[model samples]
Target: MIAFTAAEIADITNGRLAAEPGIIPGSVVTDSREATPGSLYVAKPGETADGHDFVAAAFDRGAVLALVEHDVADAAGHNYPAVVVQDSVLAMGALAAETVRRIRAAREADGQPLTVIGITGSAGKTTTKDLLAGILAAEGPTVAPQGSYNGEVGVPLTVFKADAHTRYLVIEMGATGVGHISYLADMVRPDIGVVLCVGTAHAGEFGGVENIALAKGELVEALPATGTAVLNLDDARVAAMAGRTRATVLGCTAQSAGDAQVRAGQVGLTPGGSPEFDLFLPGDPNGHHVSAKLIGAHHITNLLAAAGAAHAAGVPAGRIAESLSAQAAASRWRMERTERADGVTIINDAYNANPESMRAALRTLADLGRGRRTWAVLGAMLELGEDSIREHMAVGTQVVRLNISRLVVVGREARSLYVSAVNEGSWGNECVFAETVEDAYDLLQAELQPGDLVLFKSSNGIGLRHLGDRIALPPQAPGRTATEGSALL
Candidate 1:
């Protein structure tokens, strides 16, 4: 990432070097499949598979070295070039921290500036990261995560993508417990920290909503006094973070009447459910208008958050608006709208979910399916802890209130939603519960019409996104039609 030799990498990671003295890894990766020449592979244990097993595979892909918890032997019975550490994940973080330090030092020596922006929240972190990246890229070179790569290992992998020529690094920080965001902040040390809304996404893991706020605030807490903190004024929990950091605070809100330094006014949705609004910045009295290609009104807050960070990075208001308007949804499975050739519309937001985001998607679905029949194929929202039942019940009630045509709850974990819908007066065929994704797919296939709008939402674990993908497919050929007992589409 910063042209560090094997000796320097071992020293920086506080690990013993077992490789050739002058070897240098140009990049760092965790997956063996992504290894290339001059690549340093970090072999760590994962939930699904142990990365240590792929060390030889990585080396075979032209990797110069591997960072591992145990030494890896080559075909010659000799230890391959490696940096042996107690924990390969932590060693990778150390290497990333040093890479950032080196890039900054080099930029400082060349009188160039590199602005690192850290974004965190219970929901919308990836969307905001994508939006900010688009706005920042218009100003200069920017590096951002590919998708929702905002976890412990993901942050360092994103950091390793930065170099001296990189002008902006947008780091999305996600936390399941206390100190998680703090741990990420300690690595990149962002110059501008943006805190979006703190919601009940991870309330179960953090024990409560208050703990979520505490964890998300760590991003702002890591900023320097000279840096700026862009906070969401609409979310009281995030707004309270103004006192947590020494950095100058810049508040952003979706309301024009608010006292926020940056605000959005005249908000409205396009026919396709995308949001369009007048953007108000800090200095420019007459603000610019931005119509984002991103769907749902919930994106207004995300757009404002991106504008606030872009403003802090010295991007002009007009350029920010232009960049935002030109951008489309870059990440997959989050309000991903697909129009089938048969005239059916599919909204696949099954990437991940929480109470706040769930409500937002349901509302957007209701709005977009105004005159057309609507189908909500939902699954369980995981990690909601003790509030799981109440939250799920509330979503069911909201769906009914929205006047949706049909509700299909998939899986036993999501039984609460089906039962709540029935209890909420949606009886008989109005609400149906399926035991699996295949059952849900069959039910929708038999009932869906050409003009109907279907929405698929759940935590990624539910696998409903694949169901949405299957539903998005055009009508099958006469002989290739799906059968009840056939394999999953």
Candidate 2:
């Protein structure tokens, strides 16, 4: 939002200026409730609600400029310059791109440049993104996408955060269908592309895994010749995309994949479920081992992806190792553990889950369970389309294969998992199906005993994190610890 006039905003978005507003400032906003002074509230027509209805409300709440799909009332004492466009959402995107250009110009004017890190993958992108931001912050100022804001609109908004002091910009790119990544790629044009292991995240949306590969590959496909593509060597599909880019390829592998540019060895889980490993980069003198504080073996691969990406961006091996150990989980969501007063430990992966990620989460629970009852409270994996049943069944089977003691499956679709598990050998007695979290919690109260290790996982739509919170902190009572509920056998 480098202070632009109504005329400038109209020109950038290719809209018609309704009136002349002198040097009126522009701060991009989509939500009218979040509108502030001198803000250019973009009234977008969405499936549920249209912002055009709130144009006057935005102006009343300090907004001086409006981007609308159609003419709105400038009546009722509301007098702000308006930009009428055929499509306000598209205009927001175009304006956001223009905003990024202005921000870059301001940074260049001050003789300082911003380095952007573009990350896209099926799983581990968020963790890797959080880790990358922390590592980048270790060196200098950095701004990462807050939460899962990594789409077309989010990408440019993230890029627009760049200023004179902003040094490194970490952008996470997420694709729902084909060509989504390409649009974001066309925006930031990151110097370092971290293509983490591509799995069946949105396989059904883009037809299949092959199309998913091509979609994620869009980020690195047009990278500058000198730019570097950081890929996961352990994932063959992502590894195969290396040569598809003009950028130099840097491969990250958790396993000793015989041939890899950057490999992680001597891997073992720390006492707190963190990973301790040695990172071997290309042409390095010996290797530097990292005792990472993040949870799960899957994180070993994520850490390598981040390190290799940073190395490709010119960070030396020694510095990358330091940055790896220096990294910590930003919150208590991803595999976060909390020991209840009843001695129950809850592992929360409720932020989001897919077939690949859910299996990794269950495996981590098996690896870290302290000879206690390992319980998995899983929810529906959304956006899988036609393959949802098969995928959920795979999750149920994986639970049995891992020898987890108890399974609490939530969500309507998860009933398929329960049915699949019931059909399997040695899994029928271990599985329990619930229609909702409330049902699951009721069953949990009756079935779970003290010392049971519980894991809560689901796509964000189900809000499965509530299960973790209820377990971690039941209503605090005097003489009762943070985890007050007593576990029953």
Q: Which candidate is the best by TM-score?
A: 1
Across residues 112-159, which tens digit of lDDT does each residue of candidate 2 receive?
A: 676778999998888899888877787778888877778866776666
**Model 2 whole-model lDDT (C-alpha atoms):** 0.80
lDDT (CA) for every model shown? Answer: 0.90, 0.80
- After superposing candidate 1, which stretches have Cα over 4 Å from the reference? 481-489
* TM-score of model 1 vs. true structure: 0.97
RMSD of each: 1.5, 3.5
> Per-residue alpha-carbon lDDT of model 1 for 188-307, expressed as tens digits?
989999999999987899999999999999999999999999999999999999999999999998865666999888889999899998998988889999999999999998999999
Flag clash pairs in model 2: none
Number of backbone-clashing residue pairs for each candidate, in the order shown:
0, 0
